[model samples]
Target: MNLYAIFAIYFLMWVISAFIMLPFGIRTPDETGEVLLKGQADSAPSNFRPGLVMLRATILATILFGLYYANYVQGWVTLDMLPGYSAAQ
Candidate 1:
């Protein structure tokens, strides 16, 4: 893949990883035995750590993208392997 394609894929992977990592390690105020601030939603996390989340997301995205890139280069799986796929022209 080209540089732009790789960058785009990595960016997409990072965003996906960020969202996938968001729900984990969250602590609602009720769960943490903390009083909710004014205008804070009941489900709002009391100990939300953006830095940790970003770090974890980066790591997970790197691993995921690495596997994807390897598969792309190795052709371990391909569209032709999917059921019902047809490449006839």
Candidate 2:
């Protein structure tokens, strides 16, 4: 694929990875035994770290995108291989 296509696909993968990592490694103040700030939601995470989430998402997305690129180059899987897919006009 071209550079723009690769960049676009990788960006999509990164976004999906970020969303998948959002709920992991999170804890509410009550769960961590910390006092909640005024006006804070009850379920808000007291120790939320954007850096950690970004790091984890980057790693996950790299691995996933690597697999995707490999498949794209090798043609290991294709639309015709999927069940119920029809390539005819």
Candidate 3:
């Protein structure tokens, strides 16, 4: 629940999320013929790929950061303690 831990988790999650989404943006699109419909996104593998990638990456980063931040402030999730140390049975 400390600020240090929160910051660490946020930073770690952000970097990881950004890196993961980076690949989706870096992939080049093909010139294959496809049917286009109205109101559909035109994400061709062109110069605009990187920008779209960045946008997605940022959104993913936000989500990751939020999850990490929440987890950081959450209660205990482990119970590894043992019981019954008596000698007589």
Q: Pick the candidate with the highest lDDT.
A: 1
Query: Who is ahead in lDDT, 2 or 3?
Result: 2
Runs of candidate 2 exceeding 4 Å displacement: none
lDDT of each: 0.94, 0.93, 0.59
Candidate 2 lDDT by residue in tens digits, 1-89? 99999999999999999999999999999899989888999999888899999999999999999999999999999989989996874
TM-score of predicted structure 2: 0.94
C-alpha lDDT of candidate 1 relative to the true structure = 0.94
Off by over 4 Å in 3: 1-9, 25-48, 76-89
Flag the better candidate by lDDT, 1 or 2. 1
Q: In order, what is each prediction's RMSD in angstroms?
A: 1.0, 0.9, 9.8
Q: How far out, in Å, is residue 17 in model 2?
A: 0.3
* Distance from true location, Cα of 40 in model 3, Å: 30
In the predicted model 1, the residue pairs found to clash are none
Error of 2 at 7 (Å): 0.5
Better of 1 and 3 by lDDT: 1
In candidate 2, what residue range of length 10 has the lowest lDDT sum?
A: 80-89
